[model samples]
Every structure is written in C-alpha cells, then in structure tokens.
Target: SAPVAAAPGDNYVVDDALTGSRTRWFDEARFGMFIHFGPYAVYQGQYGSCRDAEWIKRQCNISWSDYEAKAASFNPASFDANAIVQLAKQAGQKYIVITSKHHDGFAMWPTRVNRWNLRDHAGFSRDLLRELKDAATANGIKLGFYYSIWDWHDPDFVGNFPAYVTKMKAQLQELVTNYDPALLWFDGEWTETNPTNPWSEQNGEDLERFVRTISPQVITNNRIGKRRLVDGDYGTPEQSLAGSPPSAQLQETCLTINNTWGYAAWDASFKSPTQLVRDLATLTSNGANLLLNIGPTPTGTVSAGQSGALTGMGTWMAVNGAAITGAGYTGLVGQPSWGKVTRKGNKLYLIVNSWASTLHLSRRSPFTVTGARVLGSASPVTVRAAGDGYDFLPSGGATNAIATVIEADIATPA
Candidate 1:
C-alpha cells in the first residue's frame, strides 16, 4: 500500500497518525494485539465442529432476542483486561486494539445511548473498555478501539445505513466522544467479506465532518468510503495481511493470533510461533505493523492457546524488535522474497520468512552494512560482504527460525 496523505493543517490525518515520533515509536515496536471477544465462545461445541468464530451464533440459528439473553452468560469473571494488556506488553507489543462493539451490537461499555450493551444483558455492569483503556495506559501501551460501524441491532444503521446517517453520526459521536481512542477500526461493508456485512450497508464518507469534531487529531483507517477514506492515518489490511513493513504513512495488518478472530472452542488453525514471527518480520520489511488478533472466551478471558501465541510473539519482539521498530523500508523493488523489513537511522532489520542455511542479500539499496546481528541476542552474526551487500551466515541457539533478525546499515541505491 502506498502512503495515504491526510489534509495537512490544524488536523493532520493519513491512514493513521504517523508523526515522526509515532512512526519512530511504531517502527521500533512492531507488534500489537488485536482483541475480539463476545458471546460467541459459549457455542464452542454446539455443532458437529467448533464453529468459525465470526459465525457461531448465526450458524446456531440463535434468535437475536435469545442471543441477547446470553449476555448475562457473558460473565467473564476471570476476564482480566489488565492481564491481557500486560501479556501484550511482555510480548513486545506497543499497542492494543480491543473490540468495544462488534457487529452483534453488544456494547462493551454501558452507553448512555442504549441499555442493550454488555452491561445490561450480560448482568455485568462494568465498563469493559474503561478497564482495558486504563490497564493499557497504565502499562504504557497505546490504546485503540475496534468498533464496527455496521451494527446489526442498531435499527438506525445496518441495512438502513444512509437513511440513518444522522443517527449513525450520533452513534459515532458517542463512540468518539465517550472514549478518547487512538484508532477507530471499522469493518463489514461487503457481505462476502465481513460475515454480517449485509446487516449494514456501506455508507460512504458519512463521518468526515462528524469525526472532524469528535477528535480531529484522532487516527482513522480504510473501508470508510473510497480510497480517499484511506487518508485516515493508516491503511488496514485484514487476514490477507502477512508480511509488509511499516510505511512512513502508517500501515497495519489486523490478523488473528488464532485462525479465527472470534472465540471458538475447537478452532485450532492457530499459526505456529515460527509462522507468526516470520509474518511480523515480513510486515516490518514490507513496511507495516502486525496487529495480531485474539478472540476472548464468552466470559471475556483470552483462551489459553491464544495467550500462549501472543506471549511467544512478545518474547521474540522483546529481543529482536530493535530493527522492526523506529524505521522505514528502502522499498527494495524486484526482491522475490516477500518479507517485512524495517530501518531506523542506519540500521536495517531484515525479518526472514523461513530459516535458511544460506542467506542471500538482495542488492537494492546502495548503502553498505558496517555490521550485522541477531535481533534479541547481542552476539553479532557472521555476514561476508557480498557484491553490493553482505551474505549472512546463520548460527545461534535459534529461537523459532521463522523470523531471524538481520541488522545492518543498508547501502542506499544509486
């Protein structure tokens, strides 16, 4: 994705806020946790197989009213928002984007606008997001909200989107006003793509002026209207996202830590620590950030499997993230290997996709590397100067071989 420029001035916007500092901060801290939790986990074994998270209730044929009743069962007494954020921090995450309101229209917070939120139905009167926000801030993590604009139960919106743009604006106003969010991640305009897209029609550019007021300084994402909407601070690519670097303009991939974004008891298509590390590295190399996803159980705690994966990723970043953070790629065009690369000052962080005995250095940038080292370990790896670059000879007590960090000062292409 190319850089999306925001209208410069009083309010700077571009896919997401990528100020020199934000960019530097994001580049240094490459991984983040994308959380999605709701009433879906309760039906883990309802059918013959564990349902794909996004469609559990719908597949079970549960009525809207009946599903609402499950809100009381949504008690995640063990749901420790602080623990989750702490896990992300330990996993080397710089930020956490939790879903305050998904398509099901279940508000994680007790909204003044409606009582149909998790507080009323789930018998849990606590403001879930408030706690999350506090925990995230306390842990020094940037906070963001995953709010689906396409509300299935919001009669004003959904299929009646355009007709209710006024009401939709009101809801957005409430969302933006109530919570000072870092990013407003929206989804579900295409039924073929988003499970409940048909529930809400795609109303284009409806919140430009409204959002301008609520938090003009706030960041936004793609999927609003046209590609122009991509002008919101950052470009968000979903599960299709794997390897890509953090662009100067800001780019993020919202991928599930597990195969499914929602919680399903038997869904075990989770990516291994190797695949996860490689993907994170590749995204940095390609110029993007990885928003690893986690679907919390119906009661609110992230599953054990999800927890393990995130912690593993965090462990890797805690050591090797130096290259992934605080840098932009040199746009090494024609490089066959599609992986993420990050750069800061003179340091080039190459995130390898698959472990290789013989590492080939692509000649694109013209800058010569003065040195090389594995990310987490301070011990320098051996790399012989190639024709235009250097050849890295792999050696170490290899932590998951998927994403081995190669640090160097890349030669600037002439």
Candidate 2:
C-alpha cells in the first residue's frame, strides 16, 4: 500500500502545548513492548468462523453471560511480572504498554469502581498492574496503560451513556493515581459496529483534559477521540506502517509478533527475527517508533517462539544498538535502494538491508564523508567519491545476518 497523505483536520499538526518535555524521550526511546492480556486469552481465538483473539466476543456472537463466565477461570497463575519485565529489557525495549482494560470491559487491575476485574472477578489475589509497576520501576523501564473506552459488559454503555462516561473517568483516575503510568494508549473509539458510538469529540477532549489534571506529564495516543492530532500527544499507526501522515508528524507503528494481538492457538504466522529487525530499522529511519506486541498465553508465559524471536532481536541490539537508539531521519540523503539511513548529529548510519559489494548513495550528499566503519565491529570501510555520489565498500561481507550498519562520519563545509 502507498503512504497516505495528510489532509486538513487530519490531526497532523504538531501541537507544542500537548507535547511537552516528555515527547523528546518518547521519540528517542525508539522501541517499546505492547502486551495484550485479558480473560479473552482463555478463549484463545477458538471461535469457529470468527477466529479473532481480543474481539472474539463480538465477532463470534458469544453471549455476554458466556463471555463473562470466562473470567472465573482466567487466573494467569504463571504471570511473572519480573520475568515479563526482564523480557522487555532483553528485547532492548525502553518502555511497556499493557492492556489495563480492553474492549471486553475486563480490567486487569482491581479497580475500586467495579468488580469486573482480574482480582474480584477472576478470583486472583495479586494485583497484576501493581506488580508490573514495581517490576518496571525496579528495572528502569517506563510503564504505560492501554484502556478501551468501549465496554461490552457494562450495561450503562448502551443504557445510560453519560453514566458510562462517569464510570470511565473514575476508572482512568484509578489507573493513573494507583499505577502512575508514563503514558495512556486508548482504543475502541471508532464507530464500526455501533453507528453511534456516543463517544463524541467533546467527550474525548474532556477525558484528555481530565487525564492531564491528574498526570500532567503523561503521554497519550491519537485514539483518545477521533484519532486526530489534537486528541492526544502522538499518532498511532496500527498493523500497517503505510498510514503515516508525514515525516513531520509524530507517530508510532504498533505491530503484533504474530497474526493476532491476543493468543490464538492455531495462528502460527510469526515474523522472523530478521524481518523484525529490518522493520525496526525501517521505522526508525522514517522517524517513527515501533511498539512491537506480544500476546501471552492464558498460562501467562510467552511461547518459546515469541521469546526466541525477541532474543534474536536482543542479540542484534546488544551489538549494534547505537545505530538505532536515539537515531532519527536526517533527510540529508535520499533513501538508498539497498538500505536505509539514520543520523545522530554528524554521524550517518547506513543500514544495509540487502548486502552489496559497493553501496552507492542515491544522490550527491552535502556533507563530506570523513571516515566510515562497520557498526559493532572495528572493521573499517573504504569510501570513495563516485559519480555524483559516494560508494561505500566494506572490507568483508556483512557482519550480521540481519541488517549490518555502516557508521559514516560526515562533516559540513566549514
């Protein structure tokens, strides 16, 4: 698919008021983890023709009573906060955003406003969100919460809409006050099934203002209202990366490790480590962040396949992370056919996706090349002035099986 152009009122405008000092950290963080966990995992995408994970209730036409009953058996006994945090650290992720309350209206934390939560409804004793907060703080990882405005189990959502909003605000207060998350990722605001979602732009603005009053510095996504720039601090491009408004707009691409956001017993289409690394590099090169997702099983353990893929990415990050962390699109050079480019001050990291004997720049660059070398390795690369551009010749073959980065030291004409 082609990239979408930004239109008027598309919310691509950069609002300095909404994006405070925290936006810098978010941009440089580069990579983060997105966890989708709830009672829906119990179903494991088992609905006959629906075959959906998180949206199984609505898609499969499951009765509300039957869907609510899954909560009783939804004890994720093996959910280890420390292990999950450790996995994020191992994957070189700086932050984490877990589903606090999804569309099913099942809250992961024990909310004072309602008993439809992990603790009260599922008969679980431990506070899952609190445990994660502790683990994240101890590990030096920023934590965020994913909340859904749409409620399937709540009666007020369909009966008394304003009452539902009141309850929603109360729940948001509980999450921010208790957990102190660094960000809030909202969803389920789109009017897909319900022609009239009842969640108006005014409602979203009110909620955004209310959130700032509580946690003034916390970050938020565009889904808060109509997926517009004014609704939140940044845009969330889901599943596909082609929907980015423009390079100037702040956006994060949220993608799943496999086909589903929640555990699906038969969905085995997992992206390889090479592809994941390339995707991260490409997104970073485009001045966007990647929030890779993982759907943990009902047992609360990440499958070996998912863990292994993350480990592979971690292995690469351990060596060449400098090329990614804090790097941004420079626009100094056109995107090369063989690879992508990221920059930090005078250094240009040429990320070669498809290895070649001699990588040439698409056009003549203004910055003069001083020196070049393979990132994560001491091997020097030979640079020569070619026709209208420069060519980079590596001493040997690609260093890493995945994308091998060449750090080019450049200087402007003095």
Candidate 3:
C-alpha cells in the first residue's frame, strides 16, 4: 500500500506537550477508560483474555459455524450501555475507547462490507455501537474505536498479509465514515508464522498516513512504525510502553483494569483501585496520561466489581481531579522515594506512594511552597524549610493512599 500523500492541514504540533494539539487534549484527560467486551464472555469456559494464545486456540479450534451458534444464545437483554457510559464518566474519565471488533472477526455494529456482523449473524437485533456512541456523546466523553486488524475469519487476513491490507482499507473507510473516532487503536499486527515480527516501515507509514488523511484530528497507536505510535504524544502512552512519553510532548500509558483487554471469564488479575490510582498519579507526575481499560460482557453489561472500582476512583477524583488533570510535572528537582509530582499554577501535587510515619526529603526546585492540603479532606498540612531545601508530612486519610496537595509558586527556569 503506497502512502497516499495528502495536502497539509491542522498545523498543530503533537510532538511536544507545550506546542501540541490532540496530544495535549488527550494528556489533559489524564484518565480515560478502555472498553473491550463482546459475545466471547459467554464462552468463559473456553475463552479468556485476548492477551493469552491458549484461550484463542481453544476458542478458534471450534468451527465458525459452531462459534456463530453462540450468538443465538447470546442474549444480553441486561445490557445497559448508557449506565456503562455513565460509569465511565462518573469514574472521571474524559474518553471511552471500545472494541468494535476483535480477532474473532465478529463486528459489534452492522457493516456494509461484511455481513458477519453483530446485527446479521447474532440473534441480538439491536445496535450496540450506536447505543454506545449515543451514550458517550450524551455523557460528554470522547469516543474512539478499537478494530483489530487481524480477522481470523476473514480469509484475506487470517494468516495472510498481502490480501489483508485491501480488506482493511475498505473496513477502515467504513469505520471512519460512520464513526468520527478521535483515536484509532490497531493491534494484532504480529505474524503467527514468526511471532516476533511487525509490518515493514513502508506498510506502516502508509497506514499511518492513511489515518491522518482520513481524520485530521484522529490519533493512532504506536504499533505502526515511524509515527506517533513509536513517538510520544504529549506523554500519553496507551497499551504498553518501554518508557514514559517524552517531556516535550504529552505521554500516556494505556493498561487494562485486568490482565486482559477483552472480556475474560477466568481472568482474575483485576487491579485494585489503589493500584490504579497510584499508577495514574505516577504517570501524571511524570508528564503522562493513563488510559485504563475495561472489558464489557457480551450483552453490554459491565461487571459489578468493575463498576464499583470505577466509581470508587471517581469519588477520589471528585475531590482531587484538579491535581491530576492538566497539570505539568513537578520536575522533582531530582527523584525522591516519597512518590511523584504534578503541578497546576501555584499548586504542586506530591502523590506519596508510601505509607511511612513521616516523610523526610530535600529539594531546590524552581518553585515556592505557599500552602498544602489533602485531597478528599481539606485540612492544612505542615511543611518546613529544611536545610538548603524543604520537608513536609502530607495529610492522608482512609479514603486514599496518596498524600496531600502542596501549593507552590513555579518560577521560570534560568
């Protein structure tokens, strides 16, 4: 696929956070939710997370006709898409990214290009995608789509590369036209023949160019080569990252609430709310965003535990979201064991990860401490001008493990 070079547009630079466009907006979001659910949840007995190969093998071992049979019994009449979207918003997430299709080749929405979509093959007649889209729009959360490039059922793509690109283009065009997605996450790019492989730079660059051309505001994953996929965009890294996003730009790391991206029945590696909160704080302090994921059940119902965790985090966000959102790195002067740092105007956020009796630290940062207060609990904390630096014991309560907010006046670097 030769790159279809398009005329330049949207002069916004996403390469660095300060002079950025979409990256800045996404980074400002701080915490966004990733939804990965489908008919596969019903097969909890056979399938698991999308991350494991064994689960895939077990499920794929069955013939397509047999798998399609699951659709008949897949009655998620309990699906409350609005409630799920509501949960995301309540969780203080700024965006919602859903899996439109997985490797199983089952489409969540009706597709003109492929009839093997949820509306036709599955017994469910309703439109989950449209429902989710409406729900997200109503809640003020930006919507994005995750369409796996690897379609096991598509003969052109399954174990075949040369023919897959053409099919992909058509499917992508359909998605772009119908859903004005803000982000496009393309995964399942590795080859089964040789697992340790990715597409050539030419193919990758072409695909990335195609996406940029289609949606001027759309951002893409780093799975592709020589683009933002490998580069940091405002420091937000989605999926996985070898390191944090570059400081000049916003960076983010997208990880799952559980070990799996898609709904997995037996996947019990659910992350605690504390862990999630801590991870978000750590990333934000380092000038990054955290794209947390959740997989909805086939009938569009999110698990109770998942919902609870999200709401729990939301409760904390309600009181402390200001520190997490749109704040820059504290530059820490240097790293300290207390935790990480985030700053907004004159306020500096020190997210102490440890639970020590007292915190002892020193720093000569380009900022002046004016005041300090704990989030969730607005009580004054104590700070002292330590020798050649400063020290403080931040306030904490049963509500959260993270420490209090430290107000500081940032001075221009000399």
What is the TM-score of candidate 1? 0.83
All candidates' lDDT scores?
A: 0.66, 0.85, 0.65
How do the residues 243-318 of candidate 2 rate in per-residue lDDT, one tens digit apiece?
3323555778999988899888888888998999888888888888899998999978888878888889999888
Q: lDDT, candidate 3, residue 99?
A: 79
Error of 3 at 91 (Å): 1.3
* Regions of candidate 2 where Cα sits further than 4 Å from its true position: 1-18, 48-50, 243-246, 363-365
Off by over 4 Å in 3: 1-19, 45-60, 158-163, 191-198, 226-250, 355-361, 393-404, 407-414
Judged by whole-model lDDT over C-alpha atoms, candidate 2 comes out at 0.85
Tens digits of lDDT, candidate 1, 1-414: 233454453123233332443345554556788888776656553544434565656666677776666656778777887898888888878888877777777777777667767777777867778888889888888877777766677776645555646655666677677767766776644453654444322244445445656775555655554443334456677876544332435678878766677877777767777677777766766667789988887767777788888777767777776766555565552233635456676676767665566566666645666677776666557777665555777676455455666777655545
Model 3 lDDT tens row, 1-414? 232332243122222222236555676787788877666666653542333421353445766676678754666677787887888888888888787877777777777777777777775788777787888888888888877766667776535666777767777777788877777777665453544233555666677667766766677665544442343122235555335433544455888777766666666767777777777777777777777887766666776667777887887777778878887566544446877667776667766666444555556455556666666666556777766566765555424554444444444445
Which runs in model 1 stand beyond 4 Å of their true positions? Answer: 1-29, 45-50, 158-164, 191-202, 226-231, 242-249, 332-341, 352-358, 376-384, 393-402, 410-414
lDDT of 3 at 80: 81
Candidate maximizing lDDT = 2
Q: Estimate TM-scores for all models.
A: 0.83, 0.93, 0.83
Clashes of 3: 18
Worst 10 residues of 3 by lDDT: 10-19
At residue 212, candidate 2 shows an lDDT of 71
